[model samples]
Target: MKIIPAQEFEMKRESDYGTPEQNAAVKEIIQAVRREGDAALLRYTEQHDKIKLIAGSLRVQESELQAAYDQVEPSFVNAIRAAAERIRSYHQRQKRNSWMDLQPDGSILGQIIRPLQRVGVYVPGGKAAYPSSVLMNVIPAQVAGVPEIVMVTPPATGGTEGINPYILVAAAEAGVTEMYRVGGAQAIAALAYGTDSIAPVDKICGPGNIYVALAKREVYGAVNIDSIAGPSEIVVLADDTAEPSYVAADLLSQAEHDEMASAVLVTPSRQLAEAVAVEVERQLELLPRRDIARASIDSYGAAVVTASLDEAISIVNRLAPEHLEIMTQDPMEIMGSIENAGAIFLGPYSSEPVGDYFAGPNHIIPTNGTARFSSPVDLDDFIKKSSMIYYSKEALLRDGETIMELARREGFEGHARAIAIRLEQEQASQTGGNDHEL
Candidate 1:
């Protein structure tokens, strides 16, 4: 990893990660899938994933899910169940309630919170199976009281048909009612537009590759999306007191995700930078994904030697990494000053994987500097809020003129007329006056 001075590194933009070709390819896939739904999905699956998916065989059955549970080792099943329990308990606390408030004049105003009737969760299954993604996506929707939760994954290759056993087990534990064996932009399209086999969802949530991200973007108006996720990233704001080995390990953790992943370190100590560089090189030798990690670190990762701790914090805030770790002498003192980050891990012990797995915090966070405006996935993602308003005759009479005046000021004559008509009816009902429908 290169160690640059903070001043020199400040000129970089985060969105420089993906090329225009990648974005254009994703857009074409999304448009094709939207234009041709199920047929397009099967064609893409066969071409991209090399898995032939029959229309009827797309949805996984309950019996198949149980068989998967039976096939997996008992110990791994137990772990999925335990993780599901923790995730469910944490998300249950995030559930919101509908409420309304009545004014003295009998006008009611508030928001009615309601969970989406159905939602779709996409879990990447090719090359790597993310059973954890299954748990993270489904548990929140269940806790939010969603009636139906559907999950989609790529069909297994090499005659090993069906979703991964761990994913099935996790889905069962997380209260997912339906499962589908489909992947890529086609899966996103299937969720966005109802297919003969798969039902459309209110919102789709989970991490995916570039194609999935672009598919979500294209189908955004048709269905709601959590956020347009980018490549994984981690920024560690460490001081001299932080252990070089621990910092190196955490940086490599995110680096191993993909070649596009970024792992950065910002500190005020030159000696610590050298130590971390050495440690990263030492650790890289043993990592299974060393080539990918090395590429990520070499391409996007860096260690910046800032002049002061304040300067380090400023650099981190500007970067707005998806994951920010404060491994300093007084982590708490510097934590509050950080205004942007998807998830903030305080102290040395709170590693990134802790949030990824057992920590109960959602790992599907905003990426590519989107933490400046977006937030982590939570119960709010599965629910929608509708503004509620009720007005009695007296309340309407009291506020009608104000409403009409404001509407008229905005050049909205129809809005003003609506309020005027209501006010006239309210006044007529109040006294023995002229009674006429406007």
Candidate 2:
């Protein structure tokens, strides 16, 4: 690790969009699924995942879901159930209702909030199985009252029953009614376009590799997507009062996610900066994924020294990190000044992984400075809102001219006429004659 001034520290973030070759491959895969349906889905699954499957056995049967529980340890099942409950309890507060505001003019102007009819959650099972992802993505949709929540993941191996037992157990605990043994760009296409076995979904959520990201981008307009999530990111903003060991461990937590992940520390105290840099080296040796973490620390990690605490905040806002940890004398006092961060950890005890696994909040946050504009996945991601407008006869007649004036100013003659025709009919009925005669 190296210590540099705040002015010299820059985040090395790669584009979420994959290479040209990858993009072309994704486009070809999506089109094949659209044209051939189940045939293309199975062929691609066999080619990419090395899993031969018949169309009849594509969906995960209920007996298999029940058998998954026998494979997973009792302790693992207990923890997943507890986490699911917390996640469900937390998101329950975010649930919204359909409401209408009755007006004095006898008009109802409000919004109708309804959950999407069907949603697809893509869980990555390439390098590892993310049972936590099943909880994070499925629980919120359940709280939002989504009726049909479908989940898809690649088989852990070549066999039809090669899906990871832990992931299966997690999805079952999270209340997923439908699941499929498929993965990669083919799975994304199946969710978006629909196959003979898999029904099309209204929206897709969760994280995946470069191919999966590109596939989601290609099929975006056909179905709604959560985001083109980037690699993991973490920034620890601390002062002299913060613990160096705690800071280094939290930074490494994110760095271990992948070689492209970024972990940075911004502080005003030079002594703390130097201490953390040394602590990071000592801790990296102990991590199981030290090779990945070392590459991440060597390529993208930094310890930025600033002139003042206020200046450190300015640097953080510019970066707009995905996970920000504030370890200071008074963390709460500093939190109000933070303008941009996907998730904020207030003290040393509140580590980034706390939110990633056990904490109630969703771990699916925006990345690569997208926190400046977006937010973490929540109940709103699973629901769609429709605006309700019931214009009263009195209100429409009163505001019809104003509406027409604005519409015509924008060169919309048809829009103006729509309002004009309604107004003319109402006026003629009221006066018992046409407007010209009146």
How does candidate 1 score on lDDT?
0.84
Q: Tally clashes: model 1.
A: 0
TM-score of 1: 0.93
lDDT of 1 by residue, 8-47 (tens): 8852334542467876776777778667777877888788
TM-score of each prediction: 0.93, 0.96
Native-to-model Cα distance after best TM-score fit, residue 337 in candidate 1, in Å: 0.9
Give lDDT tens digits, candidate 2, residues 1-438. Answer: 889998887778977677789999999999999999989988988899877888787899899888888888999999998888888888999988899999999999999998999999999976567899999999999999899999999876324458888998999899898999888999999999999999999999999999999999999999999999999999999999999999999999999999999999999999999999999999999999999999999999999999999999999999999999999999999999999999999998999988988889999999999999999999999999999999999899889999999999999988998999888888788889766321
**Residue 44, model 1, lDDT:** 83
Q: State the weakest 10-residue window (summed lDDT) of model 2.
A: 154-163
lDDT for model 2 comes to 0.91
Best by lDDT: 2
